[model samples]
Target: MLERLIESLEAAPMVQRGDYHYFIHPITDGVPLLDPALLRDVACAMVTVMDLHGVDKIVTAEAMGIHIGTALSLMTDIPLNILRKRSYSLPGEIAVHQSTGYSTGQLYLNGIEKGDRVVVIDDVISTGGTLKAVLAALENAGAEIVDVCVVIQRGEPELGRAYTPLVTIDVDADGVRVIDTCR
Candidate 1:
């Protein structure tokens, strides 16, 4: 189902950041070029796999998740919520702290009201720092998490919260190796 995603992942280039083997691809890195066909394929695949029914909104962290959330929302007609790096200072805004394998930053959340159902989507789940912070903020905001999914999963991230990974891969100095896929 994720044919384009898998192909892109296999062809992704890898770089070593300290001891971390980071794979750079269009979906995660926004480099090389983001193919529209690949994005459509991923959004369609997610629709088939995720239980998105009754979802009030699609939530994602800023940067990489923005595209995923946008595509998925377009496909499903669901509203999208982007937790941004900058604050709007709107009422009921919540600040989040995220520490990932490569970087750390503060993200702010808004628009998600109490009892709203949401599906969280992201580009990758390496170290799960961004997703971890996002989930915590969603919980504190009193939103019901309908589903959580990612396009690529690097290694096994102990995110505490359960998540659906569309494809799993292993990154090395050489390149990225495909490990598994959602049924």
Candidate 2:
């Protein structure tokens, strides 16, 4: 099933490469449009796997990770929580947490509870800084992470033994490259 999805994604003319073994596809010609159908398909695929593995909730970073995390939540009928890299004036004590996103920076999450089973989601995985911090937060919050879902996975350092990654691209080396046809 994943093989077919990989073939479909590879054949799609819209898919393009980015930094850190990442790839993005424009559903429309411009404006960073996201296709609901594609998102649903990806989410369903992830849920199928998660169901087999038994995951309870979906966790992810703020901003773009929300897209994949929402779809997964819907498909799995699970709650979604986000690990925020930025504080949006959310009512809380403003605790100090650190993380590295696909880029370098500190990250945070508010309102996460203890002992929740979670699956992290993201649009892509590059350097794994963000993922590492997210896992740390989940541990701090006392959530048991089962896995991670992503649209693309670039070659970078692993996020320790926390979880496994599910992504469109499995970067085998140190750099992000657009597949032959993506260019």
Query: Model-by-model lDDT, in order?
Result: 0.91, 0.58
TM-score, every prediction: 0.97, 0.69
Instruction: Candidate 2: list runs displaced more than 4 Å.
Output: 1-23, 26-31, 51-56, 88-102, 167-183
Per residue, candidate 1 scores C-alpha lDDT tens digits across 1-183 of 687788888888878888887788999979989999998988988898899989999999999999988999989899999999999999999999999977889999999999999999999998889998999999999999999999988889988877889999987788988889997
lDDT of 2 by residue, 100-164 (tens): 44345656677666766777877656567776777777787777777765556555458786443
TM-score of 1: 0.97
Residue 120 shift from truth in candidate 2, angstroms: 1.4
* Top model number, TM-score: 1
